[model samples]
Target: MDAKAWDERYAGTELVWSAEPNRFVAAETGDLPPGRALDLAAGEGRNSIWLAKQGWQVTAVDFSAAALAKGKLLADAQGASVEWITADLVTWTPKAEAYDLVLIAYLHLPEDEMQSVLAKAAHSLAPGGTFLLIGHDLANLTEGVGGPQDPSILHTPDKVSAALPGVNVTRAERVRRPVTVEGEPREAIDTLVRAVRA
Candidate 1:
């Protein structure tokens, strides 16, 4: 969606996503110590805010100004401080080896941009730092309930891991979780990748 389109979506409501951090996010990083983190495509800053609450310094980046504004407001209301940045990831030159933890959740992009973004995401991780990527699997469009309908854009764990050659992929798997949205039983098929910068 375009900036104006996203602005309109966020402009009308409180926020479509839940205020709490993603379940996968909590499960993966629960054992880690608080540290500097970067959340990419952080639409409403739910994960970023959760990191801040855990005593981690976080930077949340997104292209939509309206989303960032709501994220900031939510952060303030939660008594958490996180650096909010508005930038198009396609052109955003993220600093290499800058973050102890890098979070990328539901950041779907066109096929052409996927390789470059995945490479950039791996490059942005600090040595020994954790990189978490969660997205709707292409299989979800046909086999699962809800996600990006376009199959070309949906990603797989191997696809992401292959895009970043230097990073050591510690975990790559397709997982299923039940999501109940408005009393409807929906299953979300997500491709999750956890890597450590080598």
Candidate 2:
């Protein structure tokens, strides 16, 4: 979906996603000391706001102005300060070697675009900075639940790992997440990758 589509989607009375940070995001970053962080494609600022409360100076970027506005409202309500930027992630570049932590969650794109964005994210990290990413695994399409069905946009751990050329990969694998579907419990697969710039 483009920015306009996303804006319309977020305009509904109900929240599209929960205000809490993604489970993988909280788990992967909970122990890290506070530092400058970037949340790319940060829809509604969930992770960005959570990071701010954790003492990290955060900048959250997303293309939808409506989404950003909603995020700003939530941030204000929570007393968490976050810099929300409205721009396309594909065109918006972060300062090189600036962020201590960079996060990308569920930003699905074609393989080439995904690689390009991941490369940019890796290069934006300072030496020793941590980069964490999570998204619906390609296997989620058939063997799991919830996510885009298009195979081109879905990704695998190996594919994601290959995109980060200059990083030491700490964790790059498909992980299972428990979810309830129509009152029945099931597992959803996701690709989780954590790396540090060398």
Candidate 3:
């Protein structure tokens, strides 16, 4: 969905996604000492706020204005300091080699666009900095559950790894998340990639 559609989705009073940070995001960055962090396509700034609580200086960027507005309120209420920006991820260029951690979660797009965004994000990382991406896997449509049906926009671990040409990929594979659907347990497959810039 585009920014306008996302705005309408976030227009309601209730939260669209959970207030907590993504499980993978927390797991990967937990052990690392807090530093400058950037979250691209940071809807509602859930992960960004969490990073702030963990003592990281965070910058959250998303295209949806309504989502960021809600995020600002949530950050304020939580007393977390974060810098929020509104911009298109495909064209938004972050400062080069300035971040200790750069995270891109569930930002599904076409293959070329995804590669472009990932490359830019990887480039923003300082040496030894972490770059993590988690998203609905391409195989999820056939093997897993609950994600975008469009095959073109789905992510693959290999694709994400390929995007960060020179980076050291520590992890690149499909991970499963357990969820309940109509009282029945199900697993959702997602692509996970964690790399370190050198």
Candidate 4:
């Protein structure tokens, strides 16, 4: 969806996503010491606000102005501070080697665009900085609960690994999360990549 579509989606009374940070994000980043962090495609600022409360100076970037505004309200309510930027990830350039932690969650795009975004995200990290990414695994389409059905936007561990260079990959795999499907518990597959810049 484009920025306008996203804005309309977020214009609804209900929050499209939960206010809490993504489970993978919390688990992967919980132990890291506070530092400058970037949350790319940060819809509604859930992760960004959570990072701020954890003491990380955070910058949340999203193309939707409505989403950013909602995020600001949430941040204000929590007494958390975040620098919000409205820009497209494809066009927005973060400072090279500036962030101590870089996070991209569920930012699905075509294979070529995905690679470009991932490359930029890797370059945004400082030496020894951590880069964490989470997205719907390609397997999720047939064997999982909820995610985009288009295969072009889905990702795999191998694809993510190839997009990231100069990093020591700590974890790169298809992981499972439990979700309720028609009141029956089932596992949803997701691609997880955690790396540290060398």
TM-score of 4: 0.97
Which parts of model 2 are misplaced by more than 4 Å?
none
Q: Which residues of candidate 4, in runs, are more than 4 Å off? A: none
Write down the lDDT that model 2 would get.
0.94
- The digit string of per-residue lDDT tens for model 2 on 1-198 reads 999999999887667899999999999999999999999999999999999999999999999999999999999999999999998988888999999999999999878888889999999999989999999999999999998999899979899989997899999999999999999999999999999999
Q: Write the per-residue lDDT of candidate 1 for residues 1-82, one digit (tens) a residue.
A: 8777887888866787899999999999988888889999999899999999999999999989899899999999999999
Q: After best superposition, candidate 1 residue 190: deviation in angstroms?
A: 0.6
Worst 10 residues of 1 by lDDT: 7-16
- Candidate 3: list runs displaced more than 4 Å: none
Decreasing lDDT order of the candidates: 4, 3, 2, 1
The segments of candidate 1 whose C-alpha lies over 4 angstroms from its true place after superposition are none
- Which model is ahead, 1 or 4, in terms of TM-score? 4
Candidate numbers sorted by TM-score from highest down = 3, 2, 4, 1
Q: What residue pairs are clashing in model 1?
A: none
Q: Give the CA lDDT, 0 to 100, for residue 91 in model 1.
A: 88
Give me the overall lDDT of model 4: 0.94
